[model samples]
Target: MNIVFPTLRNGLFGAILALSPMLAAQAKTPADQLIVGMSMVNLFSIDPANAPGLDASGINANLYDTLVKRDNGNPERHVPQLAESWTVSEDGKQITFKLRSDVKFHSGNPLTAEDVAWSLYRVMKLNFGLATTWKAYGYNLDNIQASIRATDAHTLVIDLPQPTDPLLVIDSLAISPSAVVVDRKQALQHEKNGDLGAAWLVTNEAGSGPFTLSKWSANDSLVMTRFDGYWAGPAKMKRVLVRHMTESQSLRLMLERGDLDLAYGMAAPDIKAIERSDALQVQALQRGTMYYVAMSMKQPEFAKQQVREAVRNLIDYQGIDQQVMPHYGTLNQQPMQLGLAARLPDPGYTMDVAKAKALLAEAGYPNGFNTTIRILSEPPFIDIAARMQATLAEGGIKATIVTGTGNQVYGAMRARNFEMIVARGAERYPHPYFSLRTFVYNPDNSDAAGLPNFQGWRASFFNQQLNELIDRAGVERDADQRLKLYHQAQTLYDKQVGPIMMISQMTDTAVSAADVKGFTGDDAEATRYLGVYKQR
Candidate 1:
């Protein structure tokens, strides 16, 4: 898209008038605004309760306030936001939060403990995809009200429904998109059919964050205006405008011309070309999402552990990491993300065609059987799929590649209808227990269970031992014991040849102008612009 700005100084324009057309079109952004470009194809909703995409999480982070936020440097520690202080009971079944009394929503209504309680209640009540986070914690709509309630105007109390770690719940509060507090009174005013304003909140926000949602249109553009009365002080930029852009080349050109302050999802080559430029800066932000090739165990071929091991051996992990996953991700063979203390060293599985062929023969597939591989029609995913197709063929597996949009590709996996898929997903935070629970724990394996939230269930892979270990790790009070449980779960998954074979952990590259400062990305994708400002 073409972005035109007011003419610069007459002399400056005249000096560059004789230059190339590209140079002539250069435009500097306003000092008090931040112009961002990114693919908004997955950003259809801003409703915290239902919006599970990373793009939506970034937008909502600026428009809403959670009870607490994770420390950027340390993922395990949480810093207070709306909740100034909190305490856990000795029994480890209750948590009390003291909210800030001076906070107010954009609607001018006071933000009380009631708003906090209602926000969580609304999530459980809606039962959207994001509700799975709470559900996994043993909370249900029937008991959520009594379990989590407002003790007073500024005090909120949460009683655990099970024996899970209180810290994990706190971590969820800091990172879960649905944990953002909403304006209870204003939301109820627009509530229809007991949705708790779910429809209105799809585009409109009733939050007390530094920035207020000014305007938003699906697959187009969104604008956020600074809230002058914001409790945490107004954002540095008076306005943040996000243009829905899908073309990486267009993002690159706009960023080089100074017309775009920041860009996300740019191709690796473009980033490399501009890396040496003095006017631009690129930051490779590590995300907690994992990229993997998952096979549904419901398929007769994948159900056999020998066949699964053959497929695992067929993967070209080293080659893919070297060729396809440059800026997209880092080599991570484990289901858990890198940099976590509980994570074990990679098992060093390589492409062993001989071993794969032998295993396939033992599984009764002397000549590899035909299969279909589903993937998103986007970079890194399609590239990885292509490489996998070649490697699998080397082991005698004839695989056909099927490409589609994010919904089509992931939807099939979520429905348990796809034989194989290459995708990135689920846990968006760096924690051992949550990671294992996301990729290994499957409470129920029946298709009728309809638990698409768990990647394990989606792949039809279930092991009672793995589930018990993960469950024990979640509530294990002793740190060493928890680590031991986590290690045991990983070992068991490896032994069982889990269907979801992790290839890499995601790393989102954000290219921006050199002047854009304080734009630190969150591992959970909840990036806030409260401290971001242009140096100019």
Candidate 2:
């Protein structure tokens, strides 16, 4: 898929140009106005199932709803929207969710269990890692489609094909309104039109959630107003207007000029710029996300296992995080060890020029291996890739950065087109399963069961073990046993998997203090939208 982003440097991007005091003057607090510019480079579809990159997920947070929502304000807790409460069966195969009594579509249709079953089943059968959480949910379900049965109007009964743990999967997939689904056959018809039932829900609001999508002017802004019949009563803010601003300089300018109350998905370098100004304030979620460099398993250097190891031995995350992105970064962690498996491996490879040189020689690349890495056109991300290029150069890897919008890079990455890409990642939860399922494991099946697995890792030792361990994690719920299984998976992944990378230099985000409230802070992918409110 080809991708292109609009130039934020246009007159429209000039922050103070339209916000000058001489222009239309109005009395409003910074919190009263929320306008953001996303550098077109990172912009992706607002639809969850089709979102092209991490930024699209950010946009979907405002526009969509998920089942069994994660509390964005308090990441650890959950508050039901479509389903009020749920029960797990003894065998862990069946999950019965008790639906909320007073929920309706943003378009005013009463939500029901049939809608819930259809929504979950449709996502699973479509079979793209369609949604991150949905992918894991797909894996957990030996077959959820057959198991989903409506017990009553306000209840959803999901029988898992296997006894998989719900901690990671359920936390990630947001529940859509059952009233909207109506039936399974209709959703498939729309999926052909670039509209999952979720995307169609976009142009017109129809979920039993707080905000009703009032406007979605693509390539410009998206707007939402509070739902009056919302179970939570009313949101703190009156209306939420999400404008598109892709440039960091433009986003910072709007904030300084008082044209915006909050801005998120900021570039790493701009964090300091905003923090230094008294006119603006910032609050971070300590993202459960991470960014890394990846290679198509087929690349020559990566084709040789030892060459890949030499590359991993070469990344200086500590030095890069400090010098490049300047955000809070952990040198020893890959994006996988985070999310659900908080206690997973921290692969710490020190920056020893001599050792790196030694590894290169062992790999038969005494001179150096040349490579080109692709990435979205964001300054902070670009900085990280540049530093990586320099670091790899010192250890005998000549790397260059090729930048584009995420949609452009991600497609090529998936097709194994680029030698490497600076992959900025953060999962919706703290789970190893997410990483293993999506990035770590390469699914050879046409169904694409796990994810794009662009790294192309196919080590029998690693692949065989990971497949077994994921199953082991389901049956063995003893926290200790599950961890052992996870560790074995990690050891094989880190040492054998091809993409040797870092999590230090990546984008950091913040909300304008005045924009909105009631967000659950830690839930990955910012779930639990039933709790979100448009501050009044």
Candidate 3:
């Protein structure tokens, strides 16, 4: 990688200058490198088995390879990756993947079916991350090992313990980290104290992707270098340096100064201004990302369906869309996102303080109640929470807001330790099953289940009616029959009151220099960097 040294013209001032804000504004990424500025507090972890948030997952996507990959060129379609081809049993209980012979890991180890099987086993054995995703389909810690196995060097088979639609398993594995194949030999060689190299892999990568983790400093920066042995051929940019920048102004300045190639986290207003610059380009694709509020049914007040409905109806949807969400998102309330099957339009529930107050009174809280709403201390989320607070106050419900980093905010939600949380949910994979599992269905809500697969557990919300619908949807082979079951679940959720669906986000804007090529506007960061070349 190329490094540049700044010339100093003064004494103590020169030292200060080198370390000042100007350092961020003036520092230039090498021409052969791609530098990204983001507002994330810090990466949680890069290990696919443990990383919970999107930023970490995005980084991991570049370092790892999945057996199957989504076709970025065509949304919601699959393509072969580490696995060149596959076959499924007529009963749909078994899937066999044929591993590619030529793929090699960054550790220089040859790819094999053993690595694919071991990697998936590790995800379940570790009992975190995608483990919950697999659990929803009946794979458990005790049975996962037996269900997935390598019969030979080039062939791996996954036998579902229960009969279900094979598409469910295929889609789940395709987009989730559960499908990422690690270099088993390398990982086992570094294993320490029975940790299975978990500690070592946090900062290191042993996969077959185009880039390998070179360096990562918490709350500072993460640097990745292209793998010369990459199976698809070398990346155009030799290095990728992502700096932690929480401010949009700094990112704009750095880009204007030609210090950075792309800025990943820009507010809508900032993006508009940046678009006017002839040297820069901006693109936005409305993603299936949802921002909503969750109420803990554990609270006696929230347990009442009437109170939940009151809270849902108290928000001024049109006002927020016009004021807070302009250019950033659009209002969408369907349990499933639009353009997907069985999607219902917004129920047209409008703001009515009187109706909300009456409902709160009916729920045994005539004087309203006081509660806390947890939200990340960042743009749009905090601001949106404030708007909700105002509306709730109008209905005699007093809401105190709590703000923290994504980890602090989401951690509490995952642990089911909050009264309410202002959160965002997205269909990481383009499938109705993802949305159904994420928001409506939770097979096991206990902490022991590591229930990250579904938001139902977080809200302490469970309906046997909704659960049964999801279960039937899982096993139904007919597309029309499956969609009917999902529609039933949505109808049930509407009547019962689940999460307060707020807005579906539009493009997460990425501004880049004019010379950048092949950057895609996508919800999954994994697809964005693949095959993206710099046109320098």
Candidate 4:
């Protein structure tokens, strides 16, 4: 809930606003500590096996240990965390990891290969979070535990259900929910019925990371205290207080007043202004995520390819990016990002209202039609959706904007109970396979399959050709052949006119006090705080 303060023009209100900083100063964390003003309503869940929200995943990353870890700058480069070394079988069907014997959980339990096997097996059994990612690699209940087993106390072996690419499975395990290792003994102590403590772990954390959950109050704040027993040594700060601030204005005010050491989710304009401040540093981190609008093929109006193509052309890509999204996003249409190999150049489509109207007429809707645009009730997204609504109106389409929380908005999309939607998607890595698998290919669009891998099911899109291409690319051993197949998939996606993919926004801007050191601008590594410290 947002608390709207009275206008500053009011005498009493002006006085109160002026005094707020002094009041907040008393509650501020010490200079040596880190206090962040974040843009989150509340944590969805802290249990790594179940928490799918980005904020919760980030917090879990700090609270848990993974076998392999990525550096602050690069997601492709994997380094050892719990496992010091590993060997892959020549047949590419099995991998054995050597667990570091010196590591211990927060509870002082020695880390063992049994914990590794149990943690991964638990994910498949629970079947949530990254469960689908494993399913994509052919690990099912019939073969999951059979394939992943501990050979000895410190040797963890993973036998692939089918030989494809071991790197893909490893990459999936490097991400949250899949990578997270829990204290199985501790969790089982609190187990209820047959849940494996999945119920109790929802609020409590059981891991061996730099910090533990000191406290978390819904819609208000979350506090994490350092764990001195951390394998990587102690965290620099004693505590990290994350205060929930929905409005960007509140974040800017708290950051400017020194009540917050860092502020995330600031508006582009506010970020631009903060960049000029001598005491503050503003940074942008590019992520493999894209914000887009889609029209469901379930609707008769969008069933025509011409209508979908017209909707794509109707987006004022340059206008919106330059005007409202400057300093925040880059105009991109395809699933492949700019830095990756085999990425195709933009098709050079610009907004032309007349062309949109012509296309609509050709599709038997001379005056366009009515639809609802679903979006989350947050900054920039709501603002962007409003801009899209206005632009569509000019092109003879009537669009109603509906805003709600992440659950409400995305839930509707996933259930296929929507006409149009505005949402953001992130690839597991900067790989064409990830995006293609996520947005385009749907092997089983039936309700029984649960549409786990393919979000395209929501839009009622199914193409056999794309499915074949994705399958071929998945198992293709030859590098050049794989790249060619991926390119072919991208071209096929464009020709199908599936969704209106817009700009790939710079994830978030971080505005922090200059004294704050070792702040990684990468949002992908948001929870990495081992090196962060305050300069004297």
Error of 1 at 435 (Å): 0.6
Tens digits of lDDT, candidate 3, 1-536: 11111211123233223222644555455667787877556366777787756677678778888888667623446789888888889878899999889999988889999888888888877776567777777787788778899999999999998867777677666777657888999998999988777888887878888899898886567888999888888887888888776666667776777777888766667787878888899877566667787888888999998899899778888887778775567787765666776676678878998888899999999999999888765557766888989998899888888876666778788777889887776455556767777787777666676676578877777788788888888788787988888888888888888854545544467888887788776556454465676666
Better of 1 and 3 by lDDT: 1
The predicted structure with the larger TM-score, 2 or 4, is 4
- The local lDDT score (0 to 100) that residue 276 gets in candidate 2 is 63
Compared with the true structure, all predictions reach lDDT values of 0.87, 0.56, 0.75, 0.75
Query: Candidate 3: which stretches are off by over 4 Å?
Result: 1-28, 73-76, 500-502
- Tens digit of lDDT per residue, candidate 2, span 145-222? 567778888877766554567544455444221112333343444554544565563344334555666777654566
Show where candidate 4 strays beyond 4 Å: 1-23, 26-28, 71-76, 523-525
Which 10-residue span in candidate 3 carries the lowest summed lDDT?
1-10
Work out the TM-score per prediction: 0.92, 0.82, 0.92, 0.91
Estimate the lDDT of model 1: 0.87
For candidate 1, lDDT tens digit of each residue in 461-508?
999988988988888888898889888888889899999999999999
Query: By TM-score, is 2 or 3 better?
Result: 3
- Supply every candidate's count of residue pairs whose N, Cα or C atoms clash at under 3 angstroms: 0, 41, 0, 0
